[model samples]
Target: MNIRNLAATFVIALFGFFTLNLGLDYGLRNTVPHVLQRRLLNRVTADVVAIGNSVIASGFDVAAFDRASGMHSINAGLGAAEFAQQYVAWKLVTNERTDIKQVVFGTFDYSVTNTKPTKWTTWHSNNALPFYADPSWSIRYGCASRADEVVYLLARRVPLFTERGGLWTKVETLRRYLGGVGFPAAQINRFGRISDSKLLLEQNTEVFERLGRSIVETRVPLVDPVADLLKEAQQKGIASFMVLMPLPADRRSFYAMPGWKAYVVYLRELLSQTGTRLIEATEWSDSREDFADFVHLSEIGAAKFSTRLSEAMQCAK
Candidate 1:
């Protein structure tokens, strides 16, 4: 074939490929995560919107929160989410609705302030970025290290490599619809808190030391974006609270690292300065039976912790 004909054919093929991928993304995005989230939000009409990584998603039970506080709640939790993704999810929810009276932001060792930008981008950028239109410099720079995600997605047309990729994501969504998964009351209750005292102490000692070292090595800066979002929520008349959810006893030690206590102190100061409420549920020193893992809670643990949390919020008022 002549050069002109070959060029024309290549252009046509490229157009077809781009069109096919765009169509797939459009369909899957709307059908999978977006649709599931929309349904949950619709049913919620929640006064308290719980936002965080899987810890919040799996740990906080909407039914328990409602029973405890008489406040309808929605758990907008994603596992392994960084501050950038949390910020994106928060922005998306708040932008679309105005009824959320409070937002509970969960903190962990792997959040934006503690991990590198590249790490943040790799794990959180794709699932989180769709919420904003032309994200600001802060968002861009915070995710600057994640340029590889862009390259990977563009080249491979895949974001996550789990069995639930592309169309398979819809299967997970359908399973949730059929009550196969999402937030199971049984799993929540089963894994909400730790029950073994000896295990708790033994685990925490090792976990805390490693956690401290991770913080020092990464030099993870404090994530100002979360605080800024809380401030915005307050200005809009929405109350916001920062909660350091209980990790398994061993996991809580990470906060005891050399500068860990100082970090929490700084966060508390920031919350105070911003007029946001801070709930320190990290005081698991005496509680051995309330955790399931270093970071997750068993059902009994969730119940106990939720009760304490509800009482604290009430007393604060």
Candidate 2:
């Protein structure tokens, strides 16, 4: 090829690459993790920052928690988010406001396993990519961690491949969220709350039952990373708490999965050794109506749980 033609081609490729990445970042606004990034940047001060997966996001009643505890609070939960992503978010929030006094991490043993379905790109991990110092930093790490996103970036050109890459069902999620036309019963309200509604009628009746069938793995990929985060929190005199939020009555059978009980025991022991408080949902209450689905808490359920949480924790009130 002629030198001029080669130079033109190179410029086109670079421009295309940047455009693709920026589009994905813009589309990510539909997700909880992307919104959390904006939340982290705002000069929002809080005494407590609740961090976890969607369960925590839906289950923790931020308004109730703040009112009952007498501490300003915000929920920094992300769907499918695990420890490393949350730790990074913790750093970003702490960097912005030195006032965060406590961390409430709602998690389960099953989440720690490194058994994501092939082609899934976790939002917790993906959302952090844009925060890198340069574009290449995110592209390099993103491709390394989850190449499927790379495929999805290009797949939009193919007629048959219309589905979104990563965990997204479609690209409309971003627009739906950004436009404030979120799902029927669940919309992102104040403090990132996703209020429960009958509009979110259960589609998969067997979801919890399916979860019950999966064997729970005992391994945690970010063990040391979490330990390090705890150490840093301790240094700053910030208290850390972990909540094993409840599963629906029928799906609570997940506890019976082989090794799951042991995993819980291991987690409890690990938390005790690490000096973090552990709260099991069954310890104080077990209301069947609290669950929106097999895993998440309904709005009423979250309010009840948060009240109980405040009543139980000395630091909370």
Candidate 3:
């Protein structure tokens, strides 16, 4: 082809790409779960907000907690979240309303010690938090760098440049449905993607022990993102508390490990410094029946835990 024809084709292709990218980006911005979450955050009035990962996503029954505590509550838990995402959720809620008097963070050993930002990992787009997160807040919390900010801005304009976890999650759901066409339906919780449900079974005794040891031995700095989150909550006059949610029966054995106990002691000291309270509820429910899988609580379990959590807060006060 002549240079004139090639140039014309290139321009047309680029235009098509931009058109498609922007179209998808617009649709995604309106359709994702964060749109609904943002709407809720705007109007949500609560005395307490629960923030964390899948554990709290499935474990914190807002209705039960409200009923038990005699105070309104909202669960802003995000699946696949760490402190970075939790901090963003905190910012979103606090920025929108002044009713939040207490912030309850649900955690496990792995999450409590994880200082890295979610944007640095493959799970960045595991949920719609990235789409809703403020670019400046992300950088302020060390969740995203300047390069990441550029990419985030590009994603806002052209979502095709962003991670495709949401689309891939849908594709994976379809694949799982096709594969399980004739089998008994798997009991899955609503907190995370169906594709990730099997992850619970993979965390065996050995894996739990190793993870515990790593968490205990990891040299975390005195003030990391988790502490930063607690400190920020305190600065806003919102009391912060971390609840160590209960695990499955056998998995709770790790709590008895020497390293695990030491980690808890260290964690309590850290929380004390930040004016955050640490609630140890790991042994609250020893029944394997309470868990949906390995770590997340079932509906029944959530109701029980939420009530107990309310009482614990009352007692602490």
User: Residue 137 deviation, candidate 2, in Å?
Assistant: 13
Q: Candidate 2, overall lDDT?
A: 0.59
State every prediction's TM-score relative to the real structure. Answer: 0.67, 0.64, 0.85
lDDT, each prediction:
0.60, 0.59, 0.72
Over 4 Å off, model 1? 30-32, 35-37, 40-44, 109-112, 118-221, 252-258, 285-293
* Model 2 residue pairs with clashes: none
Candidate 3, residues 1-317, lDDT tens digits: the string is 99999999999999998888777666555443465356556755689989887888889999999999999988888777656666677777877578889999888755666555445334335454645566555555443567766655666444664435556767888998998899987666665444465464435656666755666567564335567778888888988889999877776567787667777877887788778888999888877678777678888999999999999998876
lDDT top scorer: 3
Between candidates 1 and 3, name the one with more favorable lDDT.
Answer: 3
Report, for all candidates in order, the number of backbone clashes: 22, 0, 0
lDDT of 2 by residue, 169-247 (tens): 4444565566665445444443333443222223343553343234334244335436666667777878888787766
> For model 3, where is the 10-residue window of minimal lDDT?
117-126
Estimate, for each residue in 1-317, the C-alpha lDDT of model 1 and write its tens digit: 99999999999998886677666555556532355356554554668888877667666777777798988877777655556666666766776687888888876543435534433333322243433223542345344446744643343333232112445545755764688445543333322223322332324545556665555555544566676678788788887787887765545445566656755665666677667787878764346666555566666776776667777778765
Question: For candidate 2, what is the TM-score?
Answer: 0.64
- In candidate 2, which residue ranges exceed 4 Å CA deviation? 1-3, 12-31, 113-222, 253-262, 282-288, 315-317
Q: Predicted candidate 3: what Cα RMSD to the true structure?
A: 3.2
